[model samples]
Target: MQRRRLLKLGIGAAVIIGVAGAGIALIKPGLVDGKLGPGAREVMRAAAQAVLSDLLPSGAARDAALQAQLARLDATIAGFPAATRKELSDALGLLGTAAGRYALVGLSIAWAQASTQDVQQALDAMRLSSSNTRQQVYHALRDLNVIAFFTEPANWQAAGYPGQREIP
Candidate 1:
């Protein structure tokens, strides 16, 4: 009876260890501050663009022009190999606070120019959100509108735009 009890105790300990190991194995690794997978990166870029476009002027000409520019950016990304995309996305994930500030500044300016009061509020909150907080990032894009508010061509050029047609 003593030997049987010892064996049962050992079996129970082994079962507990096996269950714990299985729980750990079920979790996918490689997540940095809850940011993971190619899909998350893609979603972030898309959300950023949507927030920015809302601050642009609602003119057909500006819409067409910005569409052309975005198409170019998309084409460039599409040209990258899968490995290159992964490398670049990883690098973007690892960017420091200074780079994050620059990115936020550019996006904020775009949002200010094109977005409504609601969108501006959302963008402001997002800019202040903690980098590691994916929930905040996701929430910031919750009620975003995808409109493009824009200015005149001359005004646009004055914003230091590097267009082929120089300001006369």
Candidate 2:
């Protein structure tokens, strides 16, 4: 009886999440015609701050770095195949919405208003969630931020990677 109840609860939760994700994707997609729309950028910007809290600089430099990271994120996501891009874009769209944020990220506040600490805590929750879906979301967001920030040539040095040398 307990197992049956748990199975029912899991199915119910999955359905709710699917409906919410689909609604967000239809109402306000994160990407459009291969472009990184505002919705996607908002989610990426917030997630980057959370994932790179320690690595990102402080004060004005941090603001500049975040802006640059968003640009990098746009370019990195653009390179993904259409299907993959669409899936990621939809996930970002879901995260950008208020209901989606509360459901998936555990954040009740808007991304624009969320402090780094708030976002970090929410991400930590997602990382530790028993739900595999939430865990996947955590990894995807973290990996995306890491990839976007590290892809810059200037950042390569900081990560201990010297630029490629020209072979004679």
Candidate 3:
């Protein structure tokens, strides 16, 4: 009976956390009507830096790459179906807020203010966390960053994927 009760309680807590996070997103809104509302770029930029650390070039080259990657990500996301876009927007919005950042990302610092190492550790934690929600969030961010970075043909070499040859 005790085990069953604890299981119920655990499930309930998870649901509450999920709902509260969604509530924060609803109030602050990651995107404004299927668009980048505010702080979304910072969130994505910081995440990309950490997620693609070794993959990005050094110094000024890295900065330029990030800008280009972000642009590509923005354009790609814009083309997504409305429902997927809204969900992504909501997730980004949640990460932008302090509550969501602490709860989902395990970081209290603002995305722009966080060091790449710090963000990387937080992402690692999310990846290793026992919570399914945390793992899912990590995957979403990781996949998005990876996709955004690789969309540019110039980056293919870095990923060991040479540009495709024209059909004969």
Candidate 4:
């Protein structure tokens, strides 16, 4: 009876190990542990849309719109599984940095293109902004350029941007 009990215990341990290994293999393709789980990408998309909405000219209407958009995103993401929700939340935090910088770049670009004194003043003021602010603005501009590159095939072709070219 003792021998039989020992054999059952060994079989149970082997089954547990095999299940664990299979689970890891299936869930972690490419060993990327921080992969955005199901539904997480959708949250990121919502966040991006919110940022784009917020970039509209600042005013009471815009403020209200931004708040409404954020609320919508929050509600939509609230139903995701905890692990996926956490991943989306973390990605959103990183995206916030990029969004701030993007906003700065958009503003800076607008200022640079303006022919009016008010816009020139705003641009000049932005030029004198703190180092951190400047970095955010510049980085955002770079990210925009990159995003735009991939967004349109024509734009990519016009720029002669080869996404992946094999070398000899």
Structural similarity to truth (TM-score) of each candidate = 0.32, 0.86, 0.85, 0.27
Q: Which ten residues in a row have the lowest lDDT in candidate 2?
A: 32-41
Positional deviation of 108 in candidate 1, in angstroms?
Answer: 20
- The models' CA-based lDDT, in order, is 0.42, 0.86, 0.87, 0.41
Enumerate residue pairs that collide in model 2.
none
TM-score winner between candidates 1 and 4: 1
Poorly placed runs, candidate 1 (over 4 Å): 1-58, 79-116, 131-158, 161-168
On the 0 to 100 scale, the lDDT of residue 125 in model 2 is 95
Clashing pairs in 4: none
TM-score of 4: 0.27
Which candidate order results from sorting by TM-score in descending order? 2, 3, 1, 4
Per-residue CA lDDT of candidate 4, range 51-167, in tens?
343243356765554344434444544555777655444433332332321333233322223333433343344456775654453343334324533454443453567665788
Clashes of each: 12, 0, 1, 0
- Which ten-residue region of model 4 has the weakest summed lDDT? 105-114
Q: Tens digit of lDDT per residue, candidate 3, span 1-168?
A: 699999999999979988987897788777665556667888889999999999998999999988887888887788899889888988898899887899889998999999999999999999999989889999988998898788888888987997999998
Backbone clash tally for model 2? 0
Ranking by lDDT: 3, 2, 1, 4
What would the TM-score be for candidate 1 when compared with the true structure?
0.32
- lDDT (Cα, tens digit) per residue for candidate 1, span 65-146: 4554344334444565776555434433422122332333333333224344544454565666675343343343333212
